[model samples]
Target: MPQRSAVSSATETERKYTAADSGSLPDLAGLPRVAGIDVDTVELSAQYYDTADLRLLQSKITLRRREGGDDAGWHVKLPGGVDTRTELHFPLDGAGASSDEPPAELMNLLLGVRRGMPVSLAALLTTSRHRHRLQGSDGTLLAEVVEDDVVAVRGSDGAEVNWREIEVEIAPSAGSHDMATLFEAIEQRLAAGGISRSFSPSKVHRVLGDLLPAAPELAEGARYLRDYLVHELHTLDLSDIAVRRNEPDAVHSMRKASRRIRSAVQTYAADFGLDEALVDELRWFGRRLSPSRDLEVQWERLAERVSEIPVDPYREATKTRIDEYFSAKSETARIEALAALDSQRYLSLLHSLDTLVDELGKTLPARRRKSELNPEKLAQSVAAVAKNVDKRVARVLKADDPHERDERMHRARKGAKRMRYAIEVIAPLHPKRTTRILARFDDFQDMLGEFQDSVVSREHLLDILSEQGHAAESSFGLGILYRLEGEIGRQQAAHLEPAWKKALRSAEKLWA
Candidate 1:
């Protein structure tokens, strides 16, 4: 059986003043009362692990076996807010006990990844750490000493271990000055030891760990298309996590991610092997999630706006209506979105997306070249994405009913974002053209977004009023909010027309 528990503790301390000009430690004058002896020491070697895709490392999990410290052992640092690492300790002899497999407690942390694939033993390193402590204004025990670490890494193949060092810190007090003092003190100490600041960004890199391949160098057309596709896939993955967590704005965020991915994939059909039917299905799923997400954003926005309005004759009534509408809609939308996520189709889509990403990663290498960005090709690609957005918007405009119109409009907003992102990814390649295109796209997206929000808020208000019994006096406020949303929608539509024309023109000039 594995021992599993969380111990909560608070830390507070300050580091002594360091040299003013050198940013190094100064002598401690009237150091505060030390309640306990804290050793300012250094730790040298630490190993890290991850999956083939660098999951654990990306998530900031560190597994290391260290020597030369009083608390040295096998340490698995879990992610949390502060430098407060959940240190799991073991004797040096205990190394082989879990060498072949991860402990059960650690397994829970990697639940998102599939089981049975051996956790890749990625990299090994030696880290040197210097420690320090701080006291309160009065001579009283506040926090313990901190550590500055210098690391040397043995490559994955047991080649050479490159040496680098960084500071691993903890505070005795929450104050920033104390932290700064400790940092200065440690730097001075390390400088005296002939250790300098490491040029490596992270200890993992210093060790020569496996890294994701750099983005392919492609022609302007291919690069824009590739990055656009990659962004969509990335968004989909983000939404998956948000959906699984059931976060407050998860549905909306997930829906946006999905729509963006689908739109981009569809627009750049020649660049990727996505099935049109599959993309259509994803659009359907996004539509299902939109109402709740839209309602949430709308209410939050309108609530703020309404608060700014003076106490007019209808101010109180408007607030009441908006409140009632959102309360009921939020509940219903959440329930529906969760149910949709549980469907087999949704699962299948997720699997398909994962497969698509792998396929793209494999195939893109063949089509790419190592060179500068081509302006004309990038402009053409942006035009393609914008045209896709135009089509989506046209479909939404054709929808007769409010529900259908709102749903399609949400999809259009996603299409606009993808178009925007496509231009953004290649902005470096064709700075002038991409900038102008992005600016216009942003305006179009903002208006559509506002319209969607109003639609969602109104729905939520209606739901609330319905549930609370729609008596004239009881639910009168909901009606006012709904009316306000309708007005807002009209205004948003009026604003969007000229923005669309400008964006279309920008794309054409570049493409031409």
Candidate 2:
């Protein structure tokens, strides 16, 4: 087998400032810590890579390979919290360094963002740097301040630009609170000398100039629905990246984003003249993600419930069975989810969404435009969805057969979900009222969800028990689990009426 590519990670916390050609780092000889300073200089050259459309730069991410630097190698930078970025470094080795393509290891982490798009050289930059290491009296490094003169050449147009900047980065040894104070002091000190923070997030962003899309802003002619669509699209992008990173709640969040967009489209379908095909595709995408997220929820719930079983051997056997089954199934489901994300269908869906957002943002003659959103009409639409949910709930209540009621309850839960999503779409227009209604609906939904989960759990337990197994103890344990789920389902069903009444009361506030 080929050896795995070596990788290391670091978090960069720094502020960048632009200055005049003659400007440079100012004096800090008598700052708060009375630290001594050490100075050094280095030269560096880096080749940045991205898709032809500069997708990475648009997302505030960067991929590069640098030579002549102490940490020379391939690097991937991801936007983090305020004034911070996470950097992953891969050593120059094997075919990765010699070849033009980025290493497979680093590329895998960006699968969500790139979505199988090809990456190529975007820009080349060289920097001449003067570095100052600030240290405490005891020789502990507090921060590193650097002054850089940078020259960049765009790979596309052979356009060259040169500038000077300063960076102040907090050292690992510095306390978080102390670093905040020190950074502010540095900022104020620089301001006194006519230096200010750069508007550009990175060198690549500045270099790309007009090549990237303009960041969306709310201004005149901006429709609320258009802004909402943009926000959901961005949320989908972040969720995609998180899913690739295998981060917690990534699959769940992505599914939620997909659902919100789909429901928003449906809620405004008549007004916007939106395409039904886009809604269908969104549903398809969410369905592809459902297996992984559903299994994840089931596993956590089962494992937690099993842990509460105080009995020995039976408890242990039940726990082991749940763990083994879920582990195998979750892995398979995750593989399928990733495969879906890599599919051409997914790319087509994204393009459709992009086109829809673009059309929504345009200004057109009234005759050409489909319609505009009116808050009163939107409230009526929301009420219609909620009324449908109420009908489903009534059907569940009227069902005499247990199996039929269970099925009807599941359908009611789905309707409730749709109603909640519709309310969320118009939430910005009436935050207080929508917030109240949503909270109540959430409680109602939770009860229904619990009942539905129990139904699924019982089915799973029955299947496992029917399978041939060695120990009577294991079979008995699964039998107990089935009984537990059955009882919980009954209890949740009993509680549904009260939850629905409470939700109904709060929902009235939407139009009141």
Candidate 3:
């Protein structure tokens, strides 16, 4: 059975001196000295351990076991600040015992990495430690000191090695500058002892132990796609936390992450498991969040731009117009968006994403063997995405009424965006052909984006007016903005027709 005990902190004091300076020893100065016995100031050896998932690397955790030292044990060091390491110790004897792994208290610190994986013994290091300490102005507690260790290495094979080194670690209270001062003093003393600073940072190369194998290489494209997805996922998680805490801009950040992930899915569908229908659904959520995000961006942009207007008349008018526009109906739309995100539908989408990620992780590794982006295959994929977008657009055009048209158009914009992202991915492989497709897609998307932004802004302005008890004022401005937005949409639609025709011609020519 293994027993647990808390290691008490002790105050230490010592001074480092070189062999040449040993003849001119300074008096105790009211502190005791601790010295090593018959230990040559040479180099040492050690090896570090981490999980295959790289969780420990991400968290900056260092796990090592050392030999040839009076205090050889399992050392788990968690990152503190710039210069501090929160070191935890476990006796070497219980390392093989099932009950002797790192304490349960450290589980949370490990995150999810060590949950099921067995901790294997990694390396053996031999070290000799010379300990010391520094005192405060009144001889009270200040900082402990350490001078270490020479000659460390790995492997069981008996072979001669050449490396020499020393290290000085100060107590946390000593501060960075104080630590630098102590290091300089120690170096000067070691110089007198006929010992110089080792060229290497660690003594590990001097010891003998079994060498660890290098990590296997992953498929380049797949790895790039996965890294991008992981970053977006982490951003989404952070945004969720910010929203829960009611932080400013949290909703906007969350929406952006959702959009980016949705884009990635469409872009890398060949590499990852992405269903066109499912991606459309995710885009629907992104569309719902867009109104809030757009309003936020426009407000900030307009404010910055309007501030630079040299004429007071132009500046005041622009500011008033912008303020009145945003003040209308803005609260209601923001509230609705937030409520939608909190709804069961949104949560279901999030849960689905989690499941998708897990499934992809399992299948992606196996599919690495078949990973290739042939131009013919890519052209077919692009055409397929374009066809999907056309279908959605047709539905919007077929709607009989304005309200239905608006809803369908919104859906169509999402489809167009998905197709556009698909083209973006293929652009790298078939630049000229993909460029033509993307150009058409862009024109269509920009028009739809404009239409949606107008609708959202009009709604917001009305809400703000209603809140201010100026419904009439709000209505008049909303009407003007609405009409203007309609004109913009009509203009865009007219331009897109020619662009789409050109795109089709180009796609056929290139693929032919």
Candidate 4:
């Protein structure tokens, strides 16, 4: 078996500033609880790597092989929060030190971001650092302030640029609140010397200027939709990370993001070049991740209802068995979900979205037989969906048969998703009205979702009970829960009419 490296990481929250010289590095003794400053100096050499087009850079991810630092190793930094990035470090091994090939473990972790692209060394940078460790009276380390004098050499050209910068790196234990105050105090001390936070996103970005995509001339609608699409893509990628780590809500969030992306695609079908086949492929993942969540929901609802009645040992034992069954099934589903995200096909989806965003950002001419959709026309689509939603609403309200009502309600739910996604893409343009409509859709979708869940729970319960080897109480308890689901479902059905009527009536001429 190939040695698998355990995933190791730290939250790196730091601020950077460009300086003319490190001769004026700030003294930390003035900050709160500072006892003394311990100074350390080191010579650091590192080589940064990225894809040919710099996909990793575009995503704000950095991979580097470095030496001379106390904890020198291979580092992969992923964009996290405000001034925070998740830094993963691997020991400097033969492959990384001798050449630029990153380890397999690190490469697998980045499959979602790299999308099968080859990574090449981009820049060679050497830094002379003057590190100041701020310590409290009690000897608690507060923060590390580094003054870096950097010389960057472009890999393509032998051109070298020399500069100096200041970095304020907070101790992980210092916490965000302390970090913020300390950072600001340091900022103020530096600002007095005619220095401010650097505008450049990263040292690599400053060195490899113009290699990444430039600012684009996207139209208002295209820009709004593209921003949303990019957000969903990020959400999807984060969910992938969560899934790999076995986070509780990963599959559920990923599935919801995929559904929203599909809805947005339909709302802006004419906006830009989008792949229909790719959309279908996305749906596969949502379905794959679904069984676990669906079963979890059913298990909770059924158990809650069954627990309300008098306890029965027979039913208790049966419940344990059912729980075991669902638990095993959910685990299997989770494995499948992870597999799908790691698959070649799913990697292609990320690549496709990257391409779509790139093409949409080009100089204004539509491609793939789709025209440039006007921003104002988005309102017209809203009005059209409103009209169709009203029809679907009325059909669900009038349907008498339970089976038929569910089918119509399902269609109505889809209509609600379409309308809400349309407005969501442009909510900032007309916040007040679109915001109100989206809220109404939220309530309507929830009701429909509840009904659908009850239906699924019923089917699952019946199927489970029909299997061989059941005690009287097992049958009795499950049957009671099953009937209660039907009853509760009927109650929800009765309110569908009023819910639809109110949502549709509140938004008059949706376009207006």
Candidate 5:
């Protein structure tokens, strides 16, 4: 309901290249399952727009209004990688299709990037394209290879530039075709011609390189932690986008990102200026996301375990109760979480994260070289987390009473998660060893998670029975459900020991 009209979007996955050699054309003819290569050509023109300071460019995003070819209108491209971008399109508005002013909906999508900055015309590009389409035997389109001759003019500066490149666009929705093989074969043909892949992100980047921000100069410890923080922030942003679209697993993914961000700051706070208040705020954000995610987990779990209940009118009544509760709780939780994300508070938090790396870079900018990394110091910092994991795991293993064991295992799970995230940060430094250590502890954490879930499920099931009020059949069905959950818990308990031992041994070796 944010927009009156639908926001049309698709994943744009394509590779751009400069050359494909001169001597002989590659065998781009009919390959396996391919019907033929159909050739055609077209002329395309686009006007790119952005903030005066190039805020959108800094974020590797582009908003353009174009004419010609099959798809035309205003397009917003979010750069994901060398060949991946999330593209959203809106039909051209009648008032000013080529006006400096952007559509209101497109402006809304760029709020996270623009942060209230004013936008204007950045550049204009025109291309004469010769396209080759690969199609399947049944006339299904596969990929489009286009040779583009381009001319670009900067809007403000009046500077002009031109270039030619080959762009291979795989039909992202097509999975039945062997696109990967076709891509590799194309690359091989180009490689044989002594053509190298283009390094520029896009034609716009090539023309306006001076406007983009320079890479941060960072210290060794700062480098590791900065990358960790940026990654978590990226996940956080992506998850928020998914949640806004009402996509699956968005809340869970967002929660995990918040947790990872919190853990990273806790593990290496001094490297950045991360303090206690900020950590508390992250925890607050995670808590806001948790209610929705937990309700989702409970709803799915109770439905799954209903099979264990004895088949009777009691079972039917329980199912109805569960459904009604789930419907109300889930709707409220979703609304609450979305409301928080759209609040000014969340927007301010995002703006703060926008310059997180550069701000950290200023802390210890003196050491720019790899030789400055103190291996012994790095090892000690890593070992501190590993030691914490070991202590928690040991407490869980030693606990005798059920209550004591559950409490210890809960602590152990949190510690293990923190350690696993820390290891992932340093995995490139010690890939083989860290990979082994991570797997062992991850298994241990997952087992404890299942055990804890079973405990909560049992209580919630009992609450359902208690609400039935004087119904004998309901009590009997609830008893069966509770016992089944207890048995499941026992099964998980049986699977825990070997994983614990394996994790303990691996944790010790990580420090070794």
Candidate 6:
């Protein structure tokens, strides 16, 4: 087995300006800080890698191994907010680093977009960099500005391009407001020197421009669904990276993205001709992610419920027992969830999702032209979902038996969730009409969610009670907690009628 390099990640925010090869450096010794500037020079050689089709580049992701800079190593840069990118770094001399192949772990981060395609050397860039550090009077580093003369060669054709670009990057110490002002000042100064902002996102992008993917053009009618699907796919990709990093709330986010994609696809199935098999696979993927997020939510909720015990000793005891119980459960669930994500099934699902998005983007416009993707037809479909939710709500209210009511309640919650997501997908078309309706459904779904949570909590508490080894005090506290969850469930159930009624009232105006 090949040893993988340890990876570290950080968010980088920077702006780039195209400059003429012979342009003199702009004088920045009198910017906002008006202090001395520190300057250094470095030579760098970098090898970029991506799929044969440039999948990573098309997704605005870049992977490269560079030597000669202070931070020389293999780097993966992920797209972030405006003028920002999240960078993952691996040491050059780390175990698997000798080969041309990227570290397996870092490559894994690209799986969502790579879709199991083999990556190869895409470009080679060599840069001579003049680095300038702008500083505060007390020697604080405010920002680093670099003038890079870069030569890039395309790996496929060995076609070479040379250019000079100036990059301004804010330091961690730079205040947000101050950084904005600083960038403005620097841009003005650069503009005075005849430099303009670069159109290319990166040096490699410019070198491989002809091979990059083109953005799909959507018809007016196809725009809403297409945009929503694209946005969700991007979220899923980002969340996949976050999960691989094991960042906080990563599993929850990935799960929610999966749900959003599944919901949107299911809701708009008729309009887009999405595959049912893909939906089933999405369901399977989401189920795999559920255990970790479920355990986390249950633990937090039960820990909070412990405070309602009203006795100091019992509350603390209950808290400790719940915490300990959930700690073990959460760890196991997290390990399982990550393992599932790392499996081949998850990669296949990603590939299917990628295919779906590509197909939709390419076909929706033509479908709209045929009137097969009518907005009214989409509205009617959502109305059908609303009707189902209403029927389920009615059943929940009329059920007499406790077990039947419990079963009916679960169905109602699921129905409400589907309705809310349906409205969310179509809200762009009827924003004014759907805003209040979505709010009501949000309230309805939240109440149902709490009720369902209590249901699950009570079951777990019962299992705890049936076990043999707990201290009498701990069990006593848990017993009280079990009862409390039952009471809470009843309270939530009672509130359900008014909530659904409010949601129904707002929904009535949706198609009006």
Quote each prediction's TM-score: 0.66, 0.88, 0.46, 0.87, 0.83, 0.92
Model 6 TM-score (2 dp): 0.92
Candidate 2 Cα misplacement greater than 4 A, ranges: 1-8, 29-36, 94-99, 135-142, 172-182, 215-222, 363-371
What residue runs in model 5 are displaced by over 4 Å at the alpha carbon? 1-5, 20-28, 31-38, 50-60, 79-84, 93-110, 113-120, 172-174, 189-195, 271-273, 310-321, 363-375, 386-408, 462-479, 490-501
Q: How many Å off is the CA of 228 in candidate 6?
A: 1.8
What is the Å distance of residue 43 in model 6 from its true position?
A: 1.1
Q: Which rank order by TM-score, best down to worst?
A: 6, 2, 4, 5, 1, 3
- Evaluated at residue 195, the lDDT of candidate 3 is 57
Scored by CA lDDT, what does every candidate get?
0.58, 0.82, 0.52, 0.78, 0.74, 0.83
Using lDDT as the yardstick, the better of models 1 and 3 is 1
For model 4, residues 174-225, the per-residue Cα lDDT tens digits are 7667878877887898888777788877788889867776667666778788
Candidate 2: give the clashing pairs. Answer: none
In terms of lDDT, model 2 sits at 0.82
- Model 5 C-alpha lDDT per residue in residues 23-57, reported as the tens digit of each score: 43355775545678898889999999888878777
The best candidate in terms of lDDT: 6
lDDT of 4: 0.78
**Model 2 Cα shift for residue 102 (angstroms):** 2.6
Best-first order by lDDT = 6, 2, 4, 5, 1, 3
Highest TM-score scorer: 6
TM-score of 1: 0.66
Tens-place lDDT digits, model 6, residues 209-324: 78865677775446667677777777787888888777888888888878877877887787777887877888898888898888888988888778778778777877887887
Report the error of model 1 at residue 230, Å: 4.7
lDDT of 2 at 71: 87
